[model samples]
Structures are given as C-alpha cells and as structure tokens.
Target: MDWEYFFELLLGGLTRGSIYALIALGYTMVYGIIELINFAHGEIYMIGAFTALIAANVLTMLGMNELAVLVLASVVAILYSAAYGFTVEKIAYKPLRQAPRLSPLISAIGMSIFLQNYVLLAQTSDFLPFPSLIPELEFMEPIAHIISSAEVIIILTTAVVMILLTLLIKYTRIGKAMRATAQDRSMAMLVGVNVNRVISTTFVIGSALAAVGGVLIASHIGMINFYIGFIAGIKAFTAAVLGGIGSIPGAVLGGMVLGWTESFATGYVSSDYEDVFAFALLVIILIFRPAGILGRSTTQKV
Candidate 1:
C-alpha cells in the first residue's frame, strides 16, 4: 500500500469520525441524562436532513447565495429538529417516565418507524439529491494532497461545538442542573432542579447536535433517504457504547475510533464489510471490557 494512499484514507477516516462523534454526542447525552435508549433519535437526524433540504430550497427561491442559504438552512433545520425532539420527549417519553422501561422503549421504536414512513409517504421513496452548500475545495499542497473542504468543515465545526458543549456543561447554571439530575434525579429534584425542564433541555440540545450532523452528512454525501439514519444511528450507538454511554468525552473518542475503523475496512478490505467490521469491533471491545472504555463498574448493595 502506498504511503500517500494510506494518509488519504486516514484523513477520510478522521472526517467521517468527526461526523460520527457529533451524532454519538447526541446519543451519549440523552442516554446519560435519562437511561432511555431514545431509539427515535436517529429518525430525528433523518428529519433534520429533510428540514435542511427544504430550507435550502426556500432560500434558493428567495435568491440567496449558496453560503447564505447554507446558514439559513442550518439554523432552520436545527431549530425544527430541536423542537421536534422536545415535543417527542414531552409527548412520548415524559409520560412514560414512571411507567415500565419497556413501554418507553417500545414507544421510541414506534416513533422511529412512524417518522420514517411519514417521510417516505410525503417524499417519494427515491433518494432525493440535496444541493451542495459548501464548495468542495482542496486545501493541501500537491505532494501532501491531504484534505477536502468537507473534512475541514466537519472537523472545525464539530470541534467548535464540542468546545462550546464542554463550556456549557462546565459553567452554565442549567448545565449544573443537568449534571445534578444525571447524578441523582430525585436528589436533584429535592435540590430544586426541575427534572422535566432538564430532560427537555437535554433532548433539545441532543437533537440540535444531531441536526447539525444530519446537515453535514447530507452535504457531504449530496443525497439522502428516510432510512439514512438507521445505519448511522447504529454506528453512533456503538460508538457511545464503546466510549461509555454516559461519558461525553468518551463518545467523541468512540466516534473517531469507529470512523477510522470503517475507513480502513473500506480501504483495505471491502466496503461491503464495513458494517460487519463495526459490529465485530464492538463485540471484541465488549468481550474485553464489558463496561466500556470509560465506563466504570459499580457494586450493587443488596
């Protein structure tokens, strides 16, 4: 294998990893704050892509340039997705909070299917092409030939958002409430944290991040379908599990690792086997460290 080819593959892997990291953050945050699986989170991602697509089209009709359209579309898509997420939590999850865990899980799955079919019914089952907002520019020198605009945008955008999230979780008052709730819901409530508000806020933030991921991935690939989230969701969930479901930083690490693994598998092995490789890695990791890379084992008191 040529060294240059290897470097290219690595770069591609990093770019894909960044996308996975963003999506995984959503999964990790929701899972951390509430033990629910939120199976519909992936469907939220799919909706976000469509939302961006519609927003971009509207912007285009309004005569906005590519850059402006991208910005508008992103803002609109994120807001819509966040609203949808908050609503889903309120309607589908909140009421089930005190109910059986299986009930919530089932509702999540139902929501996922409903969103998918809703999209399919509204839009044809055919894959619709999403207009490219970002130019596909190469930034590196001839010999290096290292980067693509998509990769740069994905890395820089995700880095900025991650930094902001870190700050928000560390410094903000609501962030404190969220952390407190995550630590002990009943205790946090006793301490005056509005558990409902915190949960809704968590869902909003996660959904917004997933919306960003949806836009990025759709822009990168240039086409989308209702089912796009299914595989990505599984991979992201795997990343969250790999890194430690409740750990934010762990999700980032897990996403990057999963992305690179898929890239290498596609480059060296077969693209067809990429999905298989991801699950295999997950299985291997579980076999060695059941709790996950950053997950801690806790003792139960009887």
Candidate 2:
C-alpha cells in the first residue's frame, strides 16, 4: 500500500490540527472564563497575520535575516493582537457585562464586521503573499518531501506552547487566579481575585496564541487575505465545541480530531467534500456526546 502517502496525510493533518488547536484554545479559554464566544476572536487572528506580514516585509527590506524577521514579526503580531483583544473587551464587552448574553453576542458580531471592513479599507481586498520564516535544516532534507520544515516548526511550536500554557495554568499566580475566577467569579472577587484583570488577561493570552497560529499558518500557506480569519474562526469554534467549549485540553484534542478528519477526507475522498466531512463529524459528535469529547455535562437549577 501507499504508506508514504499515508504518512504525508498524517503530517498534513497534524499541522492543520496544530493551527486549529492554537485558535481553538482562545475560544475555549474565553468561554471558560466569561462564558462568551468572543466571536471577533478570528478577526484578531487575521489582524495578527497582517501585522506579521507588514513587519516581515519591512524587516526584510532592511536586509534582516529570516530568523530575526520571524522573531520580530511574531512578537509584533502577538503584541498587536493582544492590545486589540484588550481594547475589544473594554469597548465591546465590559460595559455590557451584566446585560443579556445575546447582547454581547450581537456586539461581538458587530465588532467582527467592523474589524473585517477596517482591514479591507486599510489594506487591500487582494491576497498578500507571506514569506516563509522557518529555516530549512540539513537533517530534514530526506523527509522534507513528506513534511516540510515549516510543518515541523508548526507542530513543534504547538507542542512547546501547549506545555508552557499547561504550566502557566497549573502553577503561575495569575494562572491560579484564572482558575479561581473561572470557578466562581463572585467568590473569586470576594477572595481578592481581580476578575476584570483575569478576564482581560484571558483575552490577551488567547489572542496571542491565535496570532502565533496566524503567522505560522500564513507562512505555511504562502498567502493570506482579510477574510481568512472568518473561516478559520468558525472551524476553530467548531473544534472548541467538539472538544467541549469550556475545556482547555478538549480544545487541543478536538482540533487534532477535526484536522485528521479533514485531511483523510481530502486525501481519500475529494477536496470539495473536506468541509462537508468536517462539519458532518461535528454533527455526529454533538448528537452522541453533547457535552463534547472532554466536556462535562452540568445542570443549573432555576
């Protein structure tokens, strides 16, 4: 059999899952903290990619090395995305913190539309080419045909980020505060946890993660447009739901599952049905495991 082709698809799925996990983590984190979907999260990812593209071009024009350019671009993207996330929370969400859930959801949709148009008018409707920031390694030359250096970097980055994030959530002071806030916001506040800061921090962290994903994926795909975030955001949100929206580990697992499903469908079936299969998988998961693969089913008394 075509074992080589099988491995190629496997690697491809792994890379796709990495990006999805990064973006899905944001959705799950925000939902875990505030129980809000933060619909504009995808636009933040798009903005991060655009910011990285601009930074990379400017650095490259000045003759900066690819490594330096990549580092600077990633930093700029993360900072920019984080600031936007903070501002969005303050402007679009904070004032309505006590309002009906639908209020913020509508506001989120509006914010997303505004960001998309802002980018369209500020940048261009055309797709922009993104430079490859991952350096090639001599050791990977043999297996490069099955998985490129960029894919390797993407997967490794995701793993490192996941480990670091897990540590942060488990051991850091702010991490403890976050867990406290998520468990009981009112009680957390009573016990001296800054709910507001925790919420903002959650947004910042989530946005930063998505920005990293944005840069990595844009580099891998070679081009990006303004609306790329919308599709990616929807898929990531699906991953969050599939893995359990309020569960962090679930987001990672759901993303990997979704990515593999899409990859196999495209490789064995047809490219046109890739999304169809992905969403169909989501439907099946929802029907059987309504709380998600790792999400717990909870009931609230009226």
Point out where model 1 deviates above 4 Å: 137-145
Per-residue CA lDDT of candidate 1, range 53-169, in tens? 999998999999888998889999999999999999998999899898799999999988888899999986889999877766544434335776766888888888878887899
Clashing pairs in 1: none
Q: What is the lDDT of residue 206 in candidate 2?
A: 94
Q: What tens-digit string does per-residue lDDT give for candidate 2 at 62-89? A: 9998899999999999999999999999
Q: Alpha-carbon error at 227 in model 1, in Å?
A: 1.0
Give residue 150's lDDT in candidate 2 (0 to 100).
91
Question: Residue 72 of candidate 1: its Cα lDDT?
Answer: 87
- The best candidate by TM-score is 2
